[model samples]
Target: MNYKDLEFSTYPGFDEYILVKNLVDTPVKYKRGASYETIYNNEFNKWQDFFCQQYQVPAGKDVLLLHCCSWAKPYDFSIIINPIKQIADKYKNVHRVIMSNVGVVPYEFQMNETFCGYDFMNVDNEEKNVQEINHLYAKSLEERLFQYLESHIDRYKQVVLYSRPINMGNAPAVKNACERAGIPLIIEPNIDIYVKYRQKKYKQLDELFIEKECLDSLDKTLQLVGEKVGS
Candidate 1:
């Protein structure tokens, strides 16, 4: 059976994507001939750093960071995916981004033929001690977020993170990183919507974000940002 080849080609500069994907897909023992400790240490941290440096933007830009837990590999905007994106349109020189599970995912790269196939924001490699291992992964994610924020803080003028009040959307990681890096960040929906949504036991942010008021809050924040950035 001659399966028609998919119309896909890796970008010339992103040849590293294959190497990164393999690193994440590697097993707990790390089938590649490297020490388990070394692989575990570098897996999330080093790979995300690579992405940040590869696709970094010019200085003096505003970054509108959105969360897309529903569409892990977010290629386009939809009701559930990007209501906040429209709000960002008011602000000038604002870069639309999906601060995905793994690291920063710029909007333009989301549709890259190679990027559409996988979720760069998550790590699915299984391991023992479910809770403990996951916690370590969480720490790694936090470190990557910090590295990105620290590097971009000096470059980008302002960063506004629009997210639901849930861990699934990575609000906590950004908050922690911002605090440690002393990056002045603007948070959208700066209200206590969490306790209200506590009943849902959130594995994702789509539900809370669906509410009209939450989006209004995002719009309100961007309006202030527009005022400040003179957009």
Candidate 2:
């Protein structure tokens, strides 16, 4: 759906751009819920594979490992990696590792790179006797991930780390962990760009399809009307 077809608040950096339009129709929220497998499983996995193949991650003496749930809603993970391989190669001192929900790494795409053991990010705290999982909270997820990254940082000069937003306030933890370790930190920058594209693309949809800016009012209306709603 286009921007005009739905309603959303202006995103933080792009004050002129609406962050979302037909969110109810978008799979971002429910993509992680019970209906996720039926809706985004195949598509999300394809995206994971495509991105795993397309971008050439830089080989550096330092490694920036990422652990994310999904790149974003609708379940796409194709974020741009500027000179992906070049960056990796340039930083002879930096090696990049991306740990995700899927532990397997595409060993073929990487050339002359060090193979770091793939680590699993336990986002749901399902494992028993795992202290990290016990202490796991949205606020500390980043810190936990950072510690994980730090465990392997010694092999490289610097560690650049990133993760997806399964829970809230995760970026800060990743950022903080990077800071404490005195390593550089980078994040996937495609979501905002995609949102902008979506906003512009939907700027001129049919009036009837356009969502209004009043989410609260819409929620109330849906509650009264007994229709499914997006939160």
Candidate 3:
């Protein structure tokens, strides 16, 4: 199916439909031999340098690293990170770290003070919508997170990771990092229950199937990670 042959309609009042043929006509050019390790190492070095320049930290400070996954909407951030935040709040020495490809947190969520530090890694913007062009995007994201953890594994007293197990590309990376660091990793937290709760409470069923699929994928990812960790 040629995506260039599609037309997208505007709002209710607008009668004209925009032709996206020109936009879709140009194919995305992918980099050659792009792998998770390569991308992660590059990003890790860059971010590590940035962190060193931006913040001055004492040698022995403990960091409670909260690794967040890629989330499109503000509600997803709230739903996923809130429980993790509750857990992090228990420790006084834990320095909260939240990293994202884009530094966008919705005003309604009010998570400005929630994190002690932020790592703005613009990896997603480099990715193209075309699967063939950006097949390594998900893996790159997971590797980047793993790389961040690996870099700081020795610097902190204890490292705790809270991320949804939705991407297959980087699940192995996460498991490897956890094993190397000897840290406890928290994967999927009854997202099915969360989905049902959201459905009943908000009555937003428009994207229900999509949400369920994502949650189901996360659950599978969690299982895979558990198996790998145990092995």
TM-score of each: 0.63, 0.31, 0.39
Candidate 3 per-residue lDDT, tens place, 118-195, comes to 222334645453343244545444454455555566555554444433443333445565666676655443345444
lDDT of each: 0.54, 0.35, 0.39
Q: Cα lDDT for residue 221, model 2?
A: 26
Residues 1-231 of candidate 2 have per-residue lDDT tens digits of: 223454446545434222333323424322222122322244334333333333334343344434333232211112323223233333333344433333222223221111121222334535563444323433334444454445545543443333332233345666676777667654433234223333444432211112222222222322332222222
Query: Order of all candidates by lDDT, from best down to worst?
Result: 1, 3, 2
Error of 1 at 211 (Å): 1.7
Q: Which run of 10 residues does model 1 get worst, by summed lDDT?
A: 30-39
Q: How does residue 179 of candidate 1 score in lDDT?
A: 86
Ranking by TM-score: 1, 3, 2
RMSD to native for every prediction?
8.6, 19.9, 16.0
Better of 2 and 3 by TM-score: 3
